[model samples]
Target: MNSRDDFTEATKIKLLALAANLCSRCRVMTVGPTHSGDQRNSIGVAAHICGAASGPGSKRYDPNQTTEQRKHYDNGIWLCYSCSKLIDNEETFHDANRLKTMKANHLAYASTLVGVALMAPFEVKNEIRAGIIEATLALCGSGAGKLDLTAVLEGYEDHLKSIDPNYEVEITTTNRKVRYDITAKEGFVPSISIIPSAETRSLLFEKFENLRLTGEDIVIPSEGIDFVGIDIFQELKKTNPKSVIILKSKKHKIESELFLESDKGIFSLGSFQSLLKGGKRVQDYSGRALNGLFQYNFIVDLENEKGTMEFGSTIASWIGKKLLDIKHLPKLLKAHKFLEQTSSYKFTVECEIGNTTLKIPKGIQNQPENVLYFFRRNIKALYLLNEISKTLPIKVSIISPVTTDNSIEIADFSLLLASKPQPERLEPGTLLFNSRLDELPTPLAIDLWCQRENLYLSVTEQYNRTSDLYGNLISFPRWNFGFENFTPVLYSSIDENDRNYIFVNIYSNENTTVAFGLENGNFELL
Candidate 1:
């Protein structure tokens, strides 16, 4: 492989004699009947079956082959100048059987190689060629190191030129981008770039100063990113608009990490690199591969012991839970924001407000199967806060409608207990009831401001039940009553005093207790 492995003198002599001093394809024997000078010295060229070099663009350069196997007598195929140029144009068509068939047919016509013994039937030859072409196409995709890239590209270019003669390709590989520019005669230029993940922002940093050179180490610095003129980590590069962010993904379970941490990770290197690097196409990754560029890799790094895998499993479960559960959380963004900050005791929420969204993070536990019900009994406290916002002296309860259609809301008890109003600055206890509305808010405003807190108001329209048969004793200045958001289940009747008479029966959700009846037709709240 280090040097050119040409054929033996006997093999070369036999090939030249078989050519009979003529071009192989046309079988012309000689350019002119009695030509002299340089033409006689070079009648035909002894082409190698397998190519001479090792690269993607090289012809028949299988990496697995030894030079001895490649430079054998069977490897030589004789061809004239014109046919040699045509055969070497694309490595895809320059396969073993294709060349064998051409040499056999050419000799069969002129009867050059082996009388008629060496040549096989043409149909049988095409059948074998078809099989080779099929296998080559299949292997070209996943065969890893196999197949010639230049040959494939040359064939592709020939097809493109058939449609447009001026079709041209330009490829540029840099640290920041790998651009492929295709120019067509039809006034169109399509371009694409492949930004390698190995050069992306990553924890694994490379230091040439620390490059530990061993005795056997071959330094090929020219093949790296430094060859390109552009330097990375520039402010302008970060500001440039990007649509794709390629990241490396590794196969989990076998390895210690979730993704095989290659220098190729193209996203989320540092905090500043992600500042203006905004796009919807942030999450796509390469195919599954083990180590280098294919087969298997990991996404997260694991730091635990053998089969335990505690850290990796914990990270995986957390990711899975977030992916599946957070999507189902109530659609309220505020609820999601609040839950994102919470670290302990996950809630099994049952929201009463219609289609509310709440995002909850997975954290601490409630042991013994670890389940906690969302305490919705306090949600009515939010409505109470709403009343506090209007400065209406009201005690509010949720109207659990019996028939779904009767969903109208009315003030349950707008009874002003304090005679002297304080609308300018309501009771100091009202400080807890701040925001009147939120998308999906918790209703624990009873911490500071509620009738239960400071007790600035205590007013009920029921009859004063202190006296035995005082019929109806208490009433508001004026009243128009309805049976909606009101709490206690009560029966009412018009008394002789024309005061509102009410007898309480039952209490429901968020309204577990009934308020006191008016004492002596006098209301004072402080």
Candidate 2:
């Protein structure tokens, strides 16, 4: 085991700096308010993608590892505090389904941060620009999908170091200011000059300028070789006030190649005609109104919002025709209660399972109540079985509801056949009661049950309960529920002649299981 003492102070500082940069980038990526609804403080923490517990085993910290072996940037990702803590605990971090969700969240946050950084003022002083660039480079590295000003600074530093044996460099920066210092050999008069590269000068003037600076203060020394300090400072201030001057003649080679490698396309358009006539059509013609008839070709009658009935149709005629063919449509039959209540409709559904009831609002017509019903039923049944598994001598597993289509079932329970306790797994089972299988009961119920009994309940996935058009129902066991797995439960409904759907699923380790199917709603234990 590598102890913390093995990490030098310099290495620790670098790690912390990298962490800070990553955290800032994550915050910028998740631009909207978090679950807490606060926008100002949204930065996430930089977590070791390989888990912090890896220590010396970590690719980032392995001293003996070659640079090429540790080069991939995907090894790290930004995570919120809650997710980070889960990773640090090493409990159960890498679930394929859960990982997909987390990766999407991370990508969204990263993209937002990159955009904000690109638009942010560069802080014209050479030192500040260098510091910012360094920080960005540390977070994203050279292959970052966006522009990195830090790589440019690194090339410049490498060039300067080659020119003098005793050269020293320092960088300072704030939101408003930046400065760079370069010192030549000791015992010799230090050669100090502003960064002389044209690219560097342009970036400073174009991106940094007044956007980042607060005051128009600049200084230059006179009587030096080439451009004197006073003369350079005065000229820079007039042309680009607030610019900071630094040593110029150092062998700092700002590589144009590095500057051009940003993911953000930087090529100029030249002119509109050049772009339009050169390649494929530069504009979209689809969905364009030809003669401005009805606003656009895709326009619908305003009075018939659902577009189920043609414009200028009587409500009575629409209802009469809809009711005549109700048997052919299962979704319409399910929604008959709302359809009969009032012609002016408010999309909503209310369902009851024993004493436990739920009310879902409008706009979720795509999600069918039948699906939710099965989810809630399965969840309740699983909790009940979990309670029984603790005190009972026989191990039990329950299949619960997996889909709104009534084709899948999921179950949860633990069995101990011999003296030793067996690991929990999901299998097909009969439905004890008619209810939704995907929905789990309240957390309080599970906690109370666990404290009272030594039983562990693991509910399986929601599965298809009904056969398709054929009499045979498909049994896909791997789709069974397990802890930490994230699966989507889909439901379908129709409103106002338009069909809608809803997809939902819970993410939990202890209260999940795979979905299965059985004959006549009964399972044969395997």
Cα lDDT over the full model 2: 0.33
- The digit string of per-residue lDDT tens for model 1 on 192-288 reads 3323245431312232121221111122222121212222212112322231222222211211111111133211111100001112222111122
Error of 1 at 111 (Å): 2.6
> What's each prediction's TM-score?
0.20, 0.16
Q: Please provide the root mean square deviation of candidate 2 (C-alpha atoms, Å).
A: 31.1
lDDT (10s digit) by residue, model 2, range 1-526:
6432233344434433443344322333322355777655544553443333335433224454344323333334555666556554553545433544665564555555543634333443656656654554443333233443344555444533554546565434444233446565557674435453554566445433422222222333222212433232333233334344543322211111000001332221111110001111111101111011001011212233321111110112112222223122332232332233433322222223246432222122333344334323332332323333344444443222222223322223211111123334433232212222223465623443234333233454344322211121222222222232322333334664334433233332333343332222232222
How far residue 118's Cα lies from its native spot in candidate 1, in Å, is 21
Model 2 earns a TM-score of 0.16
* Candidate 1 segments exceeding 4 Å error: 30-39, 112-526
Model 2: residues >4 Å from true position, as ranges?
Answer: 1-46, 51-80, 88-526
In terms of TM-score, the best-performing candidate is 1
Q: Candidates' lDDT values, in order?
A: 0.34, 0.33
